[model samples]
Target: MRLPPTFYPALHDRVRIALDRAGLDALLLDDPLDVAYLTGFAHFPNERPVAAWVPRDGEVLLLVPDLEREYALDQRAAARLVVYPEFPGERGPFTVLADAVAGAVRRVGHAPSTSTGRVAALAAAFPGVEPVTSDLVGRLRLRKTPEEITLHTEAARIADAMLAEGARLVAAATGPDDLPTETELAGHVTRFGTAMMYAEHDDVVVVPMLTGGLVYGGANSAQPHRLPTADRLRRGEPFMLSLGCAVGGRFVESERTFLLGEPTAEQRRYYQVVREAQETGTEALRPGVRCVDANRTCLDVIRRAGLARFLRHRQGHGIGLGFHEPPWVADGDETVLEPGMVLSSEPGLYVPGHAGYRISDTVLVTAAGPRRLTGYPRDLDDIVIGA
Candidate 1:
């Protein structure tokens, strides 16, 4: 996984700028994506603690556990590699990191999500070092580089594949071999998505955010976030799915409502409303557009249709290194859209006793217009199967 040639150097410069602007000498990063954004090392620290130190004017130091040494070295994101032993090593991991940072530490900023012990260690190491929380990492990563954009675009392809398979499985309801139980089909989608992802980028190890998909039908479809159940698919009802696939450690959302058989007139009406709402959200996406407007556009259509109550949650979310990021498209979020910012355009509706419908497309905001990277059609007719 080779990072762009200028990625590291440019990021270091930005780090210095962020540090200077914050009136801090250095920023310590513990969040995996924060570190990856700067140094290209995307190791999930989990229980094993890892810290990447970015001094205002020196080489970056990565204090990582011994287990991640090989992977860390592969990325070459850090200058001084401080490899500490496992948890029960001669010295505590935090202490070792403190000793390293204390050498030339002053006022420093850190990830707010850092563990309490780690934050305390840093505070103790540099007693005079004023501690402060800064979302500089997230802010800096908000606008993606070209490499990042390519990674996200590719990830969206996997989502498209997953959606395609879901449509196929549901469309072939009558064929026993083609039809799979809700749980079984969810598993198949995961396996198939995994296989397809590996095929696209064999060498790159992509950690999928989640394996099992949300497969619900009949009464369960009424629940917005319900997962797959053992109940089999039934004709004349909506088969909804929220599937996923990842590439380059990035993910995108591809959610669509499926109709396994001929749908009822009511179902068609609801589907059309939701699909139009989703389009409104996507069409509203562009550089310089307000996130609030984008979100409102999605709901406004439903509101006009007198189904606004069924429109739950925000319209969408920012997509990048993680599935969900900043600048959510919802009420009161005055964030302005910018070129290269990828966001999901998901708008849905549900009635507890009736079926539900939603369509999510991972959209890329561009100067010209919004590009829907996840290319599955959202039209009610397109999604209708087994007619």
Candidate 2:
């Protein structure tokens, strides 16, 4: 799922338009992800600073340490390579970067994530130029391009396979003593998903570092953010598995709560309510719908069950290059859902000392309607293990 070389050129054209509208003569970017997004150059981000300089009417420049010069050129990045000695050298990288853009830009722009020291350095570079905050790149990333959607779809497939494998592992336990501990289950599931990703994709440079899962069983499942522990899963209890993977920098998640053994009326009731709420919230995501309204739709379902008191979080949030981004599906957010926007649909209920039930999927808002990118079953029969 490697983006074609032409992708950056088109992205550059879009940035130029954005720069014109922002009245910025140039954009000074030091964040690794932002640099990678615009220049098609992904590197090991560390304390050693790497930056991308894009001027309104000229070629892009990349400031890097001498060590990364060959690597940057090897990637065939669509930018002019500008190398410095190293970080904190006799002359710092920022000093060198300032020299590169000294006379070219008058009103320089930076992202909100930029450090205050970095902004100050840019201001000192040239007395005539002023540095100001700008969200030109962040705004451009809210909507997914067709190619990005393809990568997210592929990531979703891997997430689905991992979840199915996890269910099979739980089903293999013939008795309570045969069950695996939470840490063991989480580790094995993550390794299996990472292996599957490597076997399927030949375009990856590094290992799939973002493929992993968290397993919480029994009482621990009652906490929405609980980490995997050494507790063994017991029959007649609930276990929650949250799994995700990334492909081409795009991410997708698939999560489910499973009942280890046959029915307890309360367990069945909680699972059904959560599943219904998830479906309702996912369907409510349509073009022109406000983010708050989508969240309210899920809350309405939980309220009907008289379980609103157990609600611990919002319905979902945006997903893409980053795991969580803007246009959050929560209260006080008035962002309107539009075509090409992708979000996570998770409606959950957590009751301390009892159990928790939740189901999550990555969904895409399309012109026709909402499309579920992760195609794992949500039915109660399909999720119950070793029943």
On lDDT, the leading prediction is 2
How many clashes does each candidate structure show, in the order listed?
A: 0, 0
Q: Estimate each model's TM-score.
A: 0.93, 0.95
Q: Write the per-residue lDDT of candidate 2 for residues 247-290, one digit (tens) a residue.
A: 87788889999988896999988999999999999999999999
Q: Give candidate 2's TM-score.
A: 0.95
The TM-score leader among the candidates is 2
Q: 280-336 in candidate 1: lDDT tens per residue?
A: 789999888899988888889999999978866889999887878887999999999
Q: What is the C-alpha RMSD of each candidate to the true structure, in Å?
A: 2.2, 1.8
Off by over 4 Å in 1: 74-79, 88-90, 175-178, 208-212
Clashes of 2: 0
C-alpha positional error of residue 209 in candidate 1 after TM-score superposition, expressed in Å: 2.7
